[model samples]
Target: MATPAAYDGLISHAGSLFWIQSGEGPDQLVTWTASDGVSLAAPQGFELGNEIHAYGGGAVTASASGVWGVSSKDGRIYRLTSDKAEPLTGHTGDQLGDLVVRGETVLALREGTNGDQLVDVDTSTGHVRVLLQSSSFLSSPRPGPGYVAWLSWDADHMPWDSTQLWVARYDDRSGGSLGTALLVAGGHSESVLEPQWGPDGSLYFMSDRTGWLNLYRWDGERTYAVAPMAADCAAAPWELGYRSYTPLENRKIAMRARRDLEDHLLLVDESGHSETFQLPFTAIKPYLCTIDNAVAMIAATPTTAPAVVLVERDGSYAVIAGQEPSQDEVRQPERHSADGIDFLLHPPIDAETTWRAPVIVRAHPGPTDEISLRRDPQLDFFTRHGFAVADVDYRGSTGHGRAFRSSLYGNWGSYDVEDCAAVARHLITLGITLAGEVFICGSSAGGYTALRAATTTGPFRAASARSPIIDPKRWEASVPRFQRAHATALATGATAVSSAAIECPVLLVHGLHDPITSAQDTAALASDLKTRGADHELLMLDTSSHTLAAPDLAAQVLDAELRFFRRMLDQSESAKRT
Candidate 1:
C-alpha cells in the first residue's frame, strides 16, 4: 500500500477549516466545511510552502477577504481565491512565512540575509509595511488588538534551545511600526514557543520554565501557568505555525499534551483543572484550533493515517481528510526501556517463525525527534520480510521534558551511541534477537549514532547510514546560519569516526544535493573504506536532497539496505560452516 497523504498547518476561520495536504504532488491548501465536506482552497498547480527559518511553515491563512499562501517556487505571498491567485507581497530577495491574519493586515516573518523582520501585508490593496525589525531571527508574529507578539532568538541558539517572547504596541494607521516593547517571558535557559492571542485578550504561550513545556498566559502585567501539568504542551519549533493548543469558550483550553512520545488530548481551564479524553489517535500534529465549539487537528494512530480530525465536545472525532489502512497492513509495537532509553519493538509480522529472526535496530533522525505510535510503511516492509524492528527513542528525544531533551547537549555522539547499543544488548539479553544478526541503521544524526556504535565494541553486526555525518566539526561549519551554532553545540565532545575502526559490513547512501550533511565528506569516508578493503557499498543519488523527494528512490535505498543485511548474514553462516 502507498503511504498516506500528509496534512499540516490546521486552522479555522469563519467556521471553515483550512489545512495543507501533501504526498500527492505539491503541498496544496485544502478547506473543509460541514456542508461542503472537503475541497481545495486554491486551484491545482498553485502550491503552498515557505522558506523562512530554512524550514518553513504557517504558509496559509484565511480572512473574510479570502485565503493567502506563500509560493514554494518563489519567496512571495499570494492571495489565493477560488478563481485566481495574486501575489500580495513584492518579488524581493526576502522570504515571508508564518502568515497570520489580523484585522485587514496579514502578519508574517520577513527573512532575509540581513536579518528577520515582522511585516504586515494589507489584504485590500496588497500593500506591505514593516512592523518590527530585529537582528535576531523572528517568528510566530501574533497580532492582537493594539499589540503584536512574536518569538525572537539569537543566531547562536535554536528556538528550542533559547527564545524570548516580546510584545509591543503596533500602529498600522499610517505605515506599520512598533512602540516600546515588553519582554513577556523566556530567557537563555528557558525556551518558549507558539505565542497566541486568546478571546479574553490575554497572550497565551508555552514555556519550559518548570523543566516541561506547560501552558502559560500573560495578562499584560502578570504571567502565570494555565496548566501546570508535567506533560509537555509543545514540541521543538522545527517549523513555524505549530499551535499545540487552542483557547476555547468559557476559559477552556484544548491542548495536545505530549508524554512518553504519545499525544494526549486534554481540556484545561484557567484554574488548572484538566480532563483527559480517550481518542483513537495517539499522535497529533500542531496547530489545533476551535471549530464549532470543538477542537480540530491533524492526528494519527498505529492503524490510521494522519488526517484532519474534528474532535467534538463529547470526545468523538470524525476524520475530515485522509484514509486508514487495513488492520492487517499495520503492526503495533511493544514499548521497551533500557538504560532509561525508550524504544518500540515490533516483532516480525509472521511471529511464528521469528524465534531466530534477525533484528533491525533503527534510530530516528533529528537526534531530537521522537518516535510515536503512528503507522510507518517502512516498519511494515521490514516486519513483512521476517525482520524484527526496534525503533529507539534514545536520550535527547522530545516528549520527556526539557531536562531529558537537553541531556545530550555536551555528549551527542557518546549518549546517542551508547543508548542505541544498550537497546540492542537488552534485546539480546531478552532473547528477542541474536548477537551476530543485530544490525543498526539511521539517517542524519541518527546515522551518526549508528556509525559510532559500529566502531565500538557493541552487539551491532553491521551498520547502514544514509547521508550520515562522519565528521561533526565539518558538518557544523557547513550547516545553515540558523543551525550553525546548534550543530556546534551538538558536536561538543563528538569525535570523527575512523574508517579503520569499522569492522562490520557498512552501507552508505547519500544524496548529492544534501545541504545539511556534506556528501563530499561521505565520499571521503567511502574512499577510506575502499582503501582499507572493508565490506561496504556507497550509493549516490543525483536527484535527491537531504530528504529523498522521490518515493521510488527511497524504496530503492531501503531495498539496498535489506540486501546488504541479507548478504552479510549469509556470509556469517558460510564462515561458521567453514
Candidate 2:
C-alpha cells in the first residue's frame, strides 16, 4: 500500500505474524497482524520513523500470558492491548529508549537522547529504577526477553577495545528489580552484533572475529563457531548493516548468508551443514524460519525481493508469504539498445510525480557482467528529494554472469566512463532527459568513472562522489585493515589509464573515519585536483566511516551536490519547481 516497506527482521508467535513499518514512514509505525496472520493492521496515527540506522530496533513485547506491541518513539511506550493501544511507560515528559517485556510487567529502558542513564520503568506499577546511571552511553539491548542481553559502554562511544555482554533475568510482578547482571560472553577482538536465540536455547550471533560475518553459538559455557564463511565474507562490517536467521533452536537454526559476496541467502543446519541457493530476490532478506524443528522460511529470488519461501526438512521449497512491488511501482529503467548490448535505465521515484526530472546517470562500482538495479538507500534518497536518477547496468555490473560484469576488466576508468556517456546519449534520444541537464556521480570505483566521464566523453557539467577509491597504486599500499587485499579486485588484470581522466567541477565528500581508503589519500587526491586545475571542493565528515553518519550529515553531502548541479546546469528553478 505504501512505497515499498523494508521488512528487515521477522518473528512469529502462534500464527505467522510480523512487525512492519513503511520505508518512508515515521519511526513509530505499528502494522502487525494477529497470530493467525489474519487482521493485518497498523496502529492509527502512529507511523514508523525514518531515522538513521534503526532497522528492526523495535519488537513485539508480549508475555507468555498476554502479548503487547512496544516501541521507544517519542520517549513513550506506545502499546497495543485488547482495547485501544496506548502508552504503558513514561509520564508526559520522559522519553523511552529501547525496552522489552517479560510476563505482566513491561520494563522500558530509557537513556536520554544524549545523557547516560538507564531508566527502567515498570509497565504495571509505574515504578522506576535507575540502573547504573552513568555519564556513558549504553548501546541498544541485544534483544532477548527472559535473558535481557546488553552491551556496556563508557564515555567515548568510539567502540570499546574490549566490551562485555551482560545478561539479567527479572519477573515484573515481584519488582522491576533486574536479577543479578552477569557477563556471560566477552573478550574478543571484534564487537558483538545482532544476537538471536535459537529454538534450543542457544545464543546465535555474527562476528567479524575472523574478518567475515560468520555464525557463532553460545550456551552458558562457551561460544562455538557455527559456520565459517569465505574470507571475503564481509566486504565491510556488521555495523548497522545486516545478516539473516530465525532459529527454532540452535540445532535446527535456519539462516540466510551472503554467499559469492552479494546479498544472497544460504541454508544452514545445526550440524554445520550448509547449502547455498539463489535467493528469490537479490534485495529482500531470505530468512530461514522454523517451529518445533520443522522448518519454514520467507526467502526471495532474483526475480522477486523476499517472497516468503518455506523449506521442508526433505528439502522442498514453498512460497508462503510477503508481497511483491507492482511493476509500475518499481521504476525499471528503460533498456537502451546500443553496440549490441542492452542497458537498463533506472529512474528515481520522484520522477513519477513530476515531469522532466533531472536525470543523473551513474556508473556502478563493479564491472562484472549483468543487468541489475541494486537497491541503494542513497539512490532512493536522491529520488526521495525529487531527482530522476538513472544508473547504467552497462557493460560491467555483475548478475548477467561474469562476461558482462567483467567487460571493463583492466580498463576501469575508460570503459565505465564510456557506458555513462552512452547511457546519457541514449536517454537524451529517448527524450526522458535533456542532454545538458543530466548529472553524473558515483563512489569509490564508480566515482572514478563518473569524474572521468565528466571530463572526457560526457557532456554532464557537474560531478559528486564519496570516499573515492582513486589511484590504485596509492590505495593498495595504504588501505584499511579489512580491505588490504581487495585493491586488486578493483581491476580484472591490471594497470593503465590515469586519474587525469577525471576532470569535472566536482563536489567530493570523504570520511575521516575511513579505514578502507586513507583520509590522507582523499586529501592527496583533492590537492592533485587543484594542481591539475579542476574546479573542485572536498569536505570531510568527522567520526564517519565511509558511508558517513545518518540524517543531517547525509543531507549535507546531498545538498552540496544539489548546489553543484544547480550552479553548473542552471537548473535550480527547474529543480525547485519540480
Which has the greatest lDDT?
A: 1
Task: State the weakest 10-residue window (summed lDDT) of model 1.
Answer: 323-332
Q: Write the per-residue lDDT of candidate 2 for residues 25-54, one digit (tens) a residue.
A: 343323233244434333554533212122
Tell me the spans in candidate 1 whose CA falls farther than 4 Å from its real position: 174-176, 324-326, 353-356
Candidate 2 Cα errors over 4 Å, as ranges = 23-42, 48-56, 64-73, 81-83, 91-98, 107-109, 113-121, 131-137, 140-147, 153-163, 168-188, 231-243, 277-279, 286-461, 464-503, 506-578
Considering only N, C-alpha and C atoms within 3 Å, which residue pairs clash in candidate 1? 243-287
- Judge candidate 1 at residue 217 and give its lDDT: 91
Q: Top model by TM-score, which number? A: 1
In the range 22-129, model 1's lDDT, one tens digit per residue, is 784677788889999888888788978877777788889998878889998888888897657888877897778898887778888888888898888887788888
Collision count of model 2: 30
